[model samples]
Target: MNKLTAVAVSVLLLSAAPAQAQSIPGWKAYRAQQTGQQAAPAANAGQAPAAPPQATDPQPAALPQPAYQTAAAPYATRPAPKPAPNGGLFVGVQGGSGWVYEDVDQRAVAVSAGYRWQAGDYSQVGIELGAGRLDETTWRDYGIPEVKFNTIGANARFNFGNSPWFGVARLGYWHARSRDGWDRKVTADGAYGSLGVGVDLGRHFNLQLMYTGYTYAVDSYYGDDEYDINRADTVTLGAEVRF
Candidate 1:
């Protein structure tokens, strides 16, 4: 029996020896390594994975601007006006009747030619030459005939505004050389003044009616040899044109 116990103890010792060798630092080091690996994974559990590499945004390039240009300025000026012509000349004719009252009644018919010079818009000056025949019947001088005379004058006129109407005044000298029934041929020289109104038909035509007064001095007569003066009146109508 003792021998059998010894064999069993030997076997036991051999197994205990193997366990002691592994119990040295080597066994502890292997256990710690395994525990650390398990704890590391557990501690990192809540941590997020590294974010995927971030993509960088690209910046936009600047655009080019348009260049500025200035505009030109405007200028002002007035246009010239047309010029006007100078003086105008005109010629015309006139005809009318007259009366000389004395102890007898004498009637006359007159015809005249005239020229006018325009001084301005409102004034004019002119001259005229005329002649006429007169019929006289006094004391029933049975076979009496007609008498005739020559006349000449100068006149001035003024227009009112630009209308067709005008006021006129004239002074003139006239001579009448009697050509009929008087015993001694008589000659008369006279001063005459007149007043009238006129119408301008256009730049080319015009008409006027006037009353004239004449004062005359006679050279020879049927009765008086001295200087004897008499008054006479007349009405005239005229037409004229510009050249």
Candidate 2:
């Protein structure tokens, strides 16, 4: 019986020994596992660590803008105006007081025709031919012998200035005939000068006032005796029409 007890005790101890040993940690195996864990980091040390992802704000999209360009305009030109005709011909008439050879009692009238050209911007040069008659008293106190003396003349006129109004000057020659130079007379000539102002009533009409003087000569038939008639003065009001 003692022998049986000793054998049972040995068998129980043997079974418990394995269980206790396995429950407790082993130093060699634990150290070897720790070394393997430590060595894993060292093995990967040659490779770089990846950087952490960065947070970013979203950007707004850009809008399209309008573009501008400059271009120059084309140059333009205009035409000039034509000038008015300057070669128009005209005709006229004049009347009022006139005297012969210092005689204040002579009364006269005239008709004229003319041609002119524009000489410059505001001036004209022209020729005028005229014919007329004057009533003259040779011897008033001696029962008054009266005669209408026939006269003819020509003039060169200058018109100057540039408005509705203008100034005029004239130089001329005149011839006179006495119905009776004491009884029948011969033909003779006279000299004259004139000055005046005029207004243009419209594109084709004119009005004027003038002062003029003349030196007249005449002859009688018997010896065809010649004599001079002096200081013939005149004041004239005139009008003209143009084409």
Candidate 3:
């Protein structure tokens, strides 16, 4: 009986040794790790899930475009008097009617050419040469059949503020020749002066109203008496072009 009791006690001690190992610090954790490895799926197990395909370094995004552009737009209409050329060569013409020393109504036409330099922000100074013809005139009741005048002069022009309107003045030496109905010709030389106002068009053309006066002293003797034709006054509409 003693031997049998000793055998039974040894078998109960071996069984209790395993139960006490489960109460040890890491025995239950070790068993659960072994069971989870055996229960995992065959295809994805222990391969770290292929590292989630490594994310391929993610493609960069494209930059966005600007909202506004810098190109200029087309105009609906063109502007006038667009800041005329500062200095250049010019040509001009004039036509009108006038009186010769208050005695004759004469028709007249003239032309001029000059070179101008800019004198200020809105002004110019220049010299011009001009020639004109007069018709249907009576000189001191002499019934002159023809007359002609020529001049060499300097001129100044001014624009009013910012407008297209402008004023001009000129003065110079003048020479005149007249022929009577009897074909008797007399020549005189003196000074001429002119004043004018005008509008500038498209920076290159001008239209104006002008008044000019020519005063001449003649050194001619008619029947042993000396005669002088004082002056001729003319009003003209004029046009000019500049380059």
Candidate 4:
């Protein structure tokens, strides 16, 4: 019976030795890991909660800009327009009636030549020379002779805006030579004036109606006045050509 008891005690000692060795190192590591995990939770609880991610508004995309171009300037300057020709030589002819005293009238004819140049956009200035003849007339009981006249003058013309019509004026010196009845010669000298209106017929031709006036003096055989002075006036229709 003593041998049996000893054998049982040895078996129990052997089993308890393995259990004690494992607990010495492995059990301590496991206990420390559990203590660290529990302390981390307690430390975080003392601080404020972390802020959630802030919501940011989305920005719009930028648009592309357009490029602009400037206009180019002209390289050359333009020239001015030229003016029309406003100077020329001219010739004219006229025929109409003449008057001397009361109820005394006769046929008359004339020719003229001149040169004109521009004075303004609406006017021209010139000089003219002319000659004319008046047919014979009977004065009361005395038979008067034919008359002839020569003239030199200054002349002016005016245009009515842009129309084809114009006005003319002339003032001049005149001389008259003729023969009276009974083979007697007569002579006179005086000033003459003329005015007319005209229209252009083409580039170089024109037509006009004109009136001219002058006075002549003749010695009288029976009269209170020193000389017999008579007015000689004519109305003529004329045409002219210009160069």
Q: What are the models' TM-scores?
A: 0.53, 0.54, 0.60, 0.61
Candidate 3 residue lDDT tens string, 63-162 = 6654333333444345554455456888999999877746467888999989889887789899999999887665566664667888999977888866
Per-residue lDDT for 2-56 in model 4, tens only?
Answer: 9899999999999999788758987778878999999988999989889999999
lDDT of 1 by residue, 1-243 (tens): 699999999999999996897789988888899999999989989998778998888787766644332323234345443222212555555556566654444555666666667677578788877666667555565544455666678867787765667777777887776644556676778887879888877766678887777789765456666777787777777776666
Cα lDDT of candidate 2 equals 0.67
Best first by TM-score, ranked? 4, 3, 2, 1
After aligning candidate 4 to the native by TM-score, how far in Å is the CA of 20 from where it should be? 77
Give the local distance difference test score of model 4. Answer: 0.85
Clash count, predicted structure 2: 0
Could you tell me which residue pairs clash in candidate 3? none
Q: Pick the winner on TM-score between candidates 2 and 4.
A: 4
Ranking by lDDT: 4, 3, 1, 2
The better candidate by TM-score, 1 or 4, is: 4
TM-score of 2: 0.54
